[model samples]
Every structure is written in structure tokens, then in C-alpha cells.
Target: TILSSDAYQRSWKPNETNQQDERNFSRMVVRRLPAEVVADAITQATASNTRVTAMTSSPTDRTIGPDILAKNNKKLTSLNYTLSVFGKPDRTENCDCERSNAPTLLQAVFTRNDPSLISMINGSDRRAKGWIAEVQEWYSGKTKPTNQANGNKRLKQLNDQRKKLLAKAPKKPRNTRDAKATQRYQLTIKKHREAVQVLNRNISKLKGGRSNGNLVKRQITALETDKLINETFLRTVSRMPSANELNMARADINSNQDKIGGVKDLLWTLLNTKEFLVNH
Candidate 1:
């Protein structure tokens, strides 16, 4: 009988590996909120009718409302739930503790049309959250139609696709691949535009230039030398060259030195010229 069993085991063993063979799905034990949240959750569950009482001693001990309370004394005194994780890890024994954590309580208080969950942003945020939680729990417990599962199934698929795409995208910089990609783009892109010849070559294109847009016509600079006629009129007079009109006399001399009486007389007459109007 032992030999037959050994023969049977030998017959079942395979020498080669097959890639297409399906492997058993890995069983995952997800981290879950601990009992404290469950208890706080109970408070959240029966918030309306639930009244918490405590014993306080001033002179004598007396039964008082829960020491910390919100609007209706429904508060908690230190609500973090310490816990240990459990899972069947690879190369380890099953249900080994994975981590230690303190579970925070998620809470909500609501009236009709109020936020289902009270969040840090809004008191109503929690209330709405609680309502959503209740709805999810109903479906999770199989108490309601499994519609939530279907919804969650689609959500999980989309989330997985997004995660996969993100994972596949390049993560490391300063790589040859990145350098090549940048070089390729730089080579393909046009750095300077080609000169365009659009108008007819023979006919000068008419520019519909608005006078305002025409930038003051490259401002034709006039030669700063005085008008010949103005210089001649000044040289005709004999007057003393006043310091203010000294520049004017020089301008006259430069323009008509050749036609003047004599260089000395011209200088004398220029010095006496009345064009030098003296200040009172």
C-alpha cells in the first residue's frame, strides 16, 4: 500500500514549469478599525436616545452626564483605539501581527438635509459620511441589494487601471532615455521661422498704415545749422557781442565770414551788434 501511494505521488509530480498555469489567488487580510471605533460607532449609532453617565466626586460622588459631551453630552474621552494587525504573510506563520496602530474614530451627527458626516471642514461633513457608511454597511452585510458591491467593483477596476498607468510612467530622471527624448524634440522643432515672401514681387504692397500706428516716421533729423537767411540778417547789424548772444554771433560768422567787410571790422561790428539785447 505504501509503494502504491509513492507511485501515485510520483505520477502526479511534473518536471517542467508552465507559465500559463493559473496560480491560487493570494488571500489578503485587510487592516480594519479596532473595537474602540466599533464602540464609538455604537455611540454614533444610538446617538439620539443614548445617554452616557459617569461618576464624578466633588465632595460626594454623584452620577453625572458623560464628562465630555458635544451638543447633548455625547462626547468621548480619548477615542484612539490601539490595535494589532493580523495576516497570513509569505514565509511566515498565518495570522502573524503585521503592525501596531491607533484607530481614530470616524463620526457623524445629522438631521434631515444636514451633512451626513462631521469632518474637520464642517460639522455636517461627518453626518453625511455616516449616512454613506450606513448605506455601504447595509450592502456589505448583504442586508440590502448587492448594488453597492457592483458599484465598488467598477470603482476598484478604474482605480487599478489608474494605479497601473501611473506605475508604468517613467519615474527616474537623468536617464539616457530622457536625454534622447529631449534631443529628439529639439531636433524636430523649428527654432526660427522661414522668411515668407507673400506679396507680388513686381508691385509694391500697399500698407493700410493708420497714422497713429505709424511710429512718428523714423523722425527725420534736421541738420542743427541755422537757416542761411536768419544768419545773414544778424550779420548786417553792428552791435556789441553780448554773452547771451555770443552763440548767435558765432553762428553768423561761421555762415558769412567770406562776404563780411573785413575780418577785423566784422568782429568789431559783431561786438557792437544790437542783437545782444541787454537785460534791465
Candidate 2:
């Protein structure tokens, strides 16, 4: 019920009016996100396919077999360095206060000068084609990313998985000694149910439908310059750019000799901005 409230579901926005209405929650303040989120953003910005695997147990838990430990280590290595820079919590504290979201000098330096970030931007480490490549293809009208069929197929798979997880959930402990195991089983099921909720939200967005407006079409020729700029802004900052901002970006691209390079620089600038770096 709490999740259905306006405060919980409200979309965030920057404080554009500069009005001080703190008592009424008139606007949201921009905030530095947690380390895990920042790391995920870097991966998303680079278009890397690597995901942070859910760990079932502590990495240092000696009860786990060597094989499981090695697998966990391999998955951890992918984001460990980036997360460390933003101060990933060690999880030693009992309270959520252990994770710090304070802005730090190190974070700024890393965003500006990290070689790994540049390499990721360049599509190094066998990662999937980066966002720069995708945007370039988009500008050329070579791709149309929407497909309702695919969304429907994925929704079906998620529903099946949810059913299977429910079937496996333990109704009760096998014995008094197994009570802890039953509790853990129910927790895992709950986690999977939450994932279903997320997938449903995404499916709803897809179902909202696409139309051929004046600026862009849903079919092949979605390559209008205005469309590309708006798409970039939406993907990077979760909103469309204002007229002044859009005109400035369009002018920059038009004046630049190297079109691709200009686009790359534009995306890099956005990635480093406070809007992309935090939640508001």
C-alpha cells in the first residue's frame, strides 16, 4: 500500500524554479547515488552486457565449496574496481548508514581521468558495441529498437519462472531443525516475485504504444536529427532537453567537422554531468 502512494511513485525532477518550499516537497533535490548505482550507470553508459550477479552467500564464507567461491570471485571482479572507487559498503554494519552517498573528490577524479572508463567507452574488453556505436547507427536510420513480440515472449518466460519458483517454495520446514532453511526458501521466492514486478513495469512501458509523430517515426526512417538528440537526452538524463539546451547541442553538432566525434563528445559530457551522476 505504501508503494502505491504519490510520494513513492512520483517522478523526480531538478529544482528548476529555485523556490524554497521545503515544507511542501515542491521539488526534489539532486543527490549523489549509492556506489552500486553509480557503478551500474557506468556499465549502462558504456553499453556493457556484464551484469552484477546476485551472490547467494558471503564471498568469505568458508562453508561454500572452492568452485562456487571461484565463480563468485570472477563475477565480483567485473564491477569491483569501479564500485571500490565510489566507496562500496563492506556490509559490516547492521544499519543502512554504512553506505555513504556523499560527493567525493575521488569520484570526480575518476569520472574525468579513469583509463578504464575511456577503454569501456572505446568498446574494449570484448564488451558489446558501446552506446556511441548504437547512437551512430540510430542517427543513420538503420535500426528500429521496438518489438512488441519480443516483449510478449519475455513476459511469458518470466511468468513461467515465477510459477516454478512458487511450486518449489517450501510450505513448512521438513522438521524443527529445518525451520531456518524454510525461511531462506521463502525469502528467495520473495526476491523472484519482486523481479516479476519489475519485469511487469517494463512490459507496461512497452505497451504504452509508439506512433509516428512529426519529429520521428516508429518505422525505418526514425533518423531525424531532432529525434536523435531527444533520444540521447532521454536515455542519459531520463528527460527531454529544454529548447535552449536542444538548440545548443544541435548547433554544436552542426558546427563540428567530425560528426561522429562530436556526438561522442556530447555523450561523454552528459555522462559526466551531475544529472547523469545522481538521482533527483
Candidate 3:
């Protein structure tokens, strides 16, 4: 397995004697990730929820459920369309060599200003909620009230339904005749009550209004500058910034009055950096 192989476990630092030996696996030099991998990484890291598969395949490609697949087609359904610019494979050839890994000017341009990437970071048009929004929600101990309210309302409706189901069930000793139905009713009602309790607890935490413990309350307080910088580094580069990098990040953010915007700029800058974009 590659996971247990010497090559895969090799140190990243290049040894002077083997520096020129590309085939010998002397060191783990930086390498560009495959286009599809890059797209998947961005989707995961940013919680962009990008759809990767085409909603509609040609009838020739669809061996089953052709009519259903045809009806479900959508314009913006696949990430492959966007990834082609980065040299995603067309699968015309059987070899993996067909997928391009070489750097391109177009990829650089796309990383900097592509609307698809920007929308992922910022959020979709209908919903202005993405990584930044997620961080804000965490630090503020709140999400859009509308969403929370809707969730609570829906949960209540479901709980009410559960209650009705329970009422329709046979009662007590007589209910024992149908053991499975009585057991299911009792279990479901128990589950509904527990779920309602959890939702109410979460809502309380979101309001920053009297958590059962002080720890949760402290977590919901307004985000600190240093914490935001740390979060950006951890999310984009998968590590904490060095002292110098942290200072530089602070200086850039402190320069602006809009701290959230500063954090946004910092995140964007990090995501564009080679360290975040390539594997070393």
C-alpha cells in the first residue's frame, strides 16, 4: 500500500546528493494537485457544497431511469464544467496520463477572479452564507434567525405528529397485544421529546442567553482578531501561522476598519498562496 511505502513516507527536505534524482523519490517536492482533486478540496475546505456530477447524461450513457434523469437536469449541476479550465480529464483515453497536471496561465487567472470560486467563498446568490458566514455564526453564537425559527417550527410540527401517532396507538396493557406497534410508538415519542429538548438547548446557546455552562457562553462571544487569523490559517493552510506570518496577518487586518472584510481578504490571500494550492 502507498500509505506504508518508503516513497510516500519520504521526508520533504531534499538531500543534496539525490536532489536531481526525480525517479528515485529522494524528497517530497511540491506537486500540483489534480484538477478534480483541487475542486473537491475547495468544496470540502470551504463547505461550498459543489455538485460534482452531471444531472443529465445522454440517453446512451443512461442505461437505467432515463426519463427520471432527463427530468432532473439542471444548468449549474456539475463542477466538471468549471474544472475543465484546470485540465480535468475528458476520459477519451484509458490512461491516467490523459489528465493534465502541468501548471497553466488559465488556472492562475481562474484562481484569482473566477466567479464560481468567488461564489463558493462568498456563497450562492440566493444565500449569502459560506465560510465567513459560518465563522461569524460560530463566534456570534447565532445564525440567521429565520433559519433557526423555521427549524424550530418544523421540529414542533413533527413532534406534534409524533404525539398524534402515539394517541392513535392502543393504550397500556391492551397495547401489549401488538408489541411491535406499541414499542415503536413509545420509542418514537421518546425520540421526539429528546430531539425537541436538544433543539431548544441549541437555540438558547445561539442567543448567547444563559448556557448551562460558562464554557459554551465564552465560545459564542464576538470573535477576537487573533482567533480569526488563526482560524484562517488553519482552514486554508492546515497549520497555524508562524510568529512573523501571524504579525503580518494582524497588520493587514488591523489596517482596515471592517475587521470581517479584513479576515475575508486574509482568507482569499491564503487560498491563493502556493502553500495552500500545492502539496509539498
Candidate 4:
């Protein structure tokens, strides 16, 4: 029951509150990360000076964007990032593994963004300078990570809840009737705000909740407001792009513009990049 989405709803009480209790309720939990050790192991492995910094409620807590000067000629061929739930892939044969990985990964990655850089074997090791390298090495197996043993213990017990997807002889009958992809398919991602416009326009006809047109209009208004917020965020992010990014982007487009023409080329590039995409 504690894990249920509605669990806290039932537990709430309208009791008189003290200021101390209020402060206590608002305090954030501090959990140490196993990724710290992973970072250390990577520093040990790569022999490149890098460190991970932790997250704090400050703008200064950002670490290392991709190197702006990183060359197109030297573009990384095998860049990969892998982290599984608390119990990673192959940690355990249990039902709870997949259920637990996402939050764990978020926390681990968050903690990794902050670490104390104690020593510099190579060049000066600024605290966050080496983090990308450390993370890359850890995920790519410079050193063995810590969660595997603990996660494995619960695998069988948790996975017993569901049959393995890859089993050649599935333990139970398959449900094929609901397969949504009836053909070799194409997935079209229409612009998010653009795609939702139809729903917003006709929201009044679809009925739910406690009110009539008034309530539906309020919900649609909220969604549209959210769309505006997302646009604002993306615009702000785009404005902060590195100084030379536009020049580099233009260079890439010069080759293609002759084939597709300039107006469409500019439109496609801006629409497809981080500058225009607001992801949360």
C-alpha cells in the first residue's frame, strides 16, 4: 500500500500543525550514491582527470556540456550511456528490477554530477571537468560497479512475478490480439503543441470531471498554458547555445541547402535541434 499512487492520499490528516513539523516535512532526503564509487573506479581506469559534481539548488551546479570544439572529423563513433534500475539488466531474475531502475538511475546520475576531485594525475582536474570521462568509463566497464550483488539477490523473487520476454518457451500463453502494429510501420512525431491543438479545439465535446463546458475549457486552457511554458523554455535554452554553434550548424547546412533550398533547410535544422526541443 505504501507504494501505491493513492497511498498518501488516505494517510493525510487534518491535524493542527507546528512550525517545526512543517519544516521537517519539507526537508529533502539525502541518500549517498553508489555512482560515486563508479566515478572513482573510472578515474582509476581511464587515467584521465575527471570528477563528478553533485546537484544543489544553485545555477552554479551545472557540469560540463559537450566540448564545443569537438571536431566533426573526430566525432565519437561509439558513444553510449547505460544504466539500469537499481538492479541493472542481468542483475537479478525478479519482478521488481524494472520497476525500481528509473528513480535509482535519476538519483545516481544526479549525484554523479557532483564529486570532490581529490587528485589530478594528468592535467589540472577541475571538479567537474572529468565527470563525462568518469561516467563514460564506469558505464562502459572501466571498473565493476557496486549495485550488481545487492540487486541480484532480489531478482529471482521479483521476476517470479512475470515470465521473461525472451524465453523461447514462454511460461504462459501470449496475448497477440492487442498488437497495435499490424504492418511494417512508420511512426510520425507531429510537433507536440501542433498535434495537441485539435484536442484543445474540440475539448468541449469530450466529457468528464464535475463541470460542463466551463471545466473542459479550464483544462484546455491549462494545457495550452503549459505549451507556452515549454516554448519559452526551449527558446531560452537555444539563446544560450555556445558562441560558435551557429557557425558550425551553418557549415553542416551549406552542403544540404543546395539540395533542399535555404528556407526549408533553416526550418528543419532549428526544429530538429535542442534549441527548439523542450524535454523534461
The RMSD of every model to the true structure, in order and in angstroms, is: 49.3, 20.0, 11.6, 26.7
lDDT of each: 0.30, 0.62, 0.64, 0.32
Per residue, candidate 4 scores C-alpha lDDT tens digits across 34-96 of: 322333333332233222224333333322223232234332211112222122344366664
Per residue, candidate 3 scores C-alpha lDDT tens digits across 1-280 of: 9999977887778787878777766766677887766765665455522221221333332121123342465322245545687677777999877788788998888788887677666645212246775665554545434566666666566566656655665344465689888787788767767766665666555555423332232232134888888877876788999999999988887887666678878888887899877986
Return the top candidate by lDDT. Answer: 3
| Residue range 1-280, candidate 1, lDDT tens digits | 8777754445333334432333521222223333333334323332221121211223221211222333333332222221111111232535535432332222111211112212211212211232223322332443333554454555555556545644554333355578877675554432211111222211122221112222231211122122222332343332233555556544554555342222222333322232321111
- The TM-score between candidate 4 and the true structure equals 0.15
lDDT, candidate 4, equals 0.32
lDDT of 2 by residue, 6-53 (tens): 877765553555356555655676568877777666665556222112
Indicate the TM-score of model 1: 0.14
Which portions of model 1 show Cα errors greater than 4 Å?
1-141, 172-180, 183-280
TM-score of each: 0.14, 0.49, 0.57, 0.15
Q: Name model 3 segments beyond 4 Å from true.
A: 1-12, 48-77, 125-128, 136-223
Q: How many clashes does the backbone of model 2 have?
A: 0
In terms of lDDT, the poorest run of 10 residues in model 4 is 76-85
